[model samples]
Target: MTIKVFDTHVRTKTSRYLHFDVLIEGNDTEKAQAHARQYLLEKGLTDEDIAQSECRFCHVEPGNPVVAQAISQQGYYILELQGCQED
Candidate 1:
């Protein structure tokens, strides 16, 4: 299967922006953003904090077994690039 990668930035309540990549099953940016927001919520961030998030389509590529499995189970896979520890 192929996957879409979204380059995402999210501002925390602590006033720091986090950089991460979201890998999902489709090319829809809104769905990717939603998944990113859900991840932040699961990591103890509030909706206000997630309100400042920005997500853009970075690229698309063929999926391997690991990420494919992750997306199948959780609907998305987070690939942290820099500036945060919410992985």
Candidate 2:
């Protein structure tokens, strides 16, 4: 299972949280989520730690894709996905 991760600059009204979007090739939501969760765990995040982690799916169409947009806009890549929160 190959997964790609990209950084997203997510900002809300009151708070700012860094975002990492994971891109998977196939259209299996369950598998994609599992892979993402596993990746997070490998980074040393306990299940409890990422209970509130935000993840979403993207449906790309011809000529433009959400993952591509995220990478271009945010300048994030797969390597940035590794690592747990440093606090």
Q: TM-scores, in order shown? A: 0.85, 0.46
How accurate locally, in lDDT, is each candidate?
0.85, 0.46
Off by over 4 Å in 2: 1-18, 61-87
**Cα RMSD for candidates in order:** 2.1, 8.9
Model 1 lDDT per residue over 1-87, tens place: 899999998876677778989999888888998888887777778787554778999999999999999999989999987766743
Best by lDDT: 1
Per-residue lDDT of 4-75 in model 2, one digit per residue for the tens? 432323333333243555555445556555655665566555555543555555543332364556445643
Q: Which regions in candidate 1 have their CA more than 4 angstroms from the true location?
A: none
Candidate 2's displacement at residue 1, Å, is 14
